[model samples]
Target: MEFDMVAAALRQDAADVATYARVLTVTLADVLPPGSVTVEYERSLGDRLKGREGHPSRIVVRLGERTLSLTGGHRPVAEVHHEVRGVVLSRDQVSLDVWVQALARELVAQAEADARAAEALRRLVTGA
Candidate 1:
């Protein structure tokens, strides 16, 4: 079958981005086919306030046929590692510049895979 996959990231507050990343990861997995999407998150510590410190966060997403990953980090200092995956025709990404770049690359890879799948399907259908 021919498939099309698109991935994108939206700049938003650290907390909101984290929340949405997690929620979307689960939702996408449930809705999409098996093993098609991935989500990740990275969280870091923030500045010290009255001896209390905060953190910065980022998010990432991957949407494809065989692999999907998303990562996000949380606010003052940021550390990223968390990741998840699912299946769907939709897209996913991390709002951070670095993660977004990586996700973009993965999207291209997925597109290639989708194209190959399409070509194979066509060949099968035509018996050629």
Candidate 2:
């Protein structure tokens, strides 16, 4: 988890969104509990034609039965899926900036309470 890199990518306008998404997924997967997050990879048509390896294309984070997913690309948006009663509900087109800020805040809160999380976050912010 390159914590400093993730923060830089999120802040810099010229940063690659795909790379940001990938790094974010990796860091969250490390800090969060196991099996809570998953990532999918795919090659674009051009990449496939050129025989390049697939890149991370989707990331999903599950909290109980509800899930939040984001697509990795030039412009990323978040979608939330959950069930109520017997019906499945979905909220689409959530702003990526808002979603990330919420996650960042949650991570900070967790860091404040847990020594391990604090260390992970410390590494993330300081790149140590």
**Best lDDT goes to which candidate?**
2
What is the alpha-carbon lDDT of model 1 when measured against the actual structure? Answer: 0.37
TM accuracy, model 1: 0.30
Please give, for residues 3-24, the per-residue lDDT of candidate 2 as tens digits: 3444453454223446555555
Model 2 per-residue lDDT at 46: 91
lDDT tens readout by residue for model 1, 8-102: 32222123554545433442233333444433333234334334323213333334332323333233222223344433444443334444345
**Reference-based lDDT, each prediction:** 0.37, 0.60
lDDT of 2 at 114: 67
Compute each candidate's TM-score over C-alphas.
0.30, 0.62
Q: Candidate 1, residue 112: CA error in Å?
A: 2.4
Give lDDT: candidate 2, residue 30. Answer: 55
Best by TM-score: 2
**Model 2 vs. true fold: TM:** 0.62
